[model samples]
Target: MNTPSVELADQVARAARYLRPHIQRSALEGKRELPTPCADFDVHRLSEHLLGSLVAGARAAAKEPLPADAPTTLTEPPWVVFPPLLDSLAAAWAEPGAWKGEALFAGSVRPASFAGTITIMELTVHGWDLATAAGRTFTTDDDVIATATAVAAQIAEGARARGIFGPEAEPAPDAAPLERLLALTGRKSL
Candidate 1:
């Protein structure tokens, strides 16, 4: 099998660092129960979901089998678990062979690059979701924003059908790239 592209793997690593600050305990204070743009998920629930997804992404990158009954929700404080989970994901994807073949994602076989790209999408989008819920400023480099925008567009239709994303909401013409990306994922930028 051909090696998975390093480009997306690098993006995943950058994304992990990009997301770390947003999930800090101090940033999330008093905002645990606040609702986010990601429908039905408050800040805390979304945090748990993000962490769980990171675990799954790491397993996928490492070509490890997913547990039959992995818990979707986290019992531990998300801020505490978030950094390490991000690190795990980034490190797993950085492995030279990680992207060499098909990997399991959401119980289906997909190109390793697909899994990595999706992970990047999750980190950026959910990072925005968490920061927005906490009334914190959210920002990322233009390249990351561009990559996320492309991913959001690629997955918008299928993701909506799977309930991973809601129906697309159009952003204002003058909206920033990050806001436009969020709109594609059915999130209203604050």
Candidate 2:
């Protein structure tokens, strides 16, 4: 990671830890065929994508090659089994220079700056998707939101063009941070 980007990158880990439980209990789980907050992915599709990306994100953080495909679901209580995976991810990135350079993702050598921010985008927005599908609340401190928003602003348009995020839908003038974050990612908060 770029020196200044380290702090924001760390936020991705925090967001992941914060959202894991809600993902475990997501109402969208097991209903793999329903629509999600994102226009392209339905519940089942997003769930699978989320699971695979968790594994991939860890790999990216570790400076390892991301596998072509990752699994969408686990037996149960991944909160217990998945910690090691997350631990590996955290540990990989914990290295002094883990974020020092560009990382491989989906067969592409993405810029160093993209590694953490994209992870934050995927986890935070998809976590919100799961939480919303479950009729739950997803909260974050101002700093996390700031980092997420900043990352969104940096790459959201590119993501949209690449068919990652949906088309931009502006948020209300007075929308809160989380709401602004969601809208930037093309998910309406309301």
**For candidate 2, what is the TM-score?**
0.82
**What local lDDT score does residue 176 receive in model 1, on the 0 to 100 scale?**
87
Model 2, span 28-142: residue lDDT tens: 4565555668776766666667767778877887788865456557555444545666566656656656666888876689864577666677777887886776667888667
Q: For each candidate in the order shown, give its overall lDDT on alpha carbons.
A: 0.82, 0.70
The candidate maximizing lDDT is 1
Estimate candidate 2's alpha-carbon lDDT, on a 0 to 1 scale.
Answer: 0.70
Candidate 2 stretches greater than 4 Å from native:
1-6, 26-34, 68-82
User: Which structure among the candidates has the greatest TM-score?
Assistant: 1
lDDT by residue for model 1 (8-109), tens: 678788888878888887888778899998889988888878867898899999988788776677777777777778878888998998877889888899
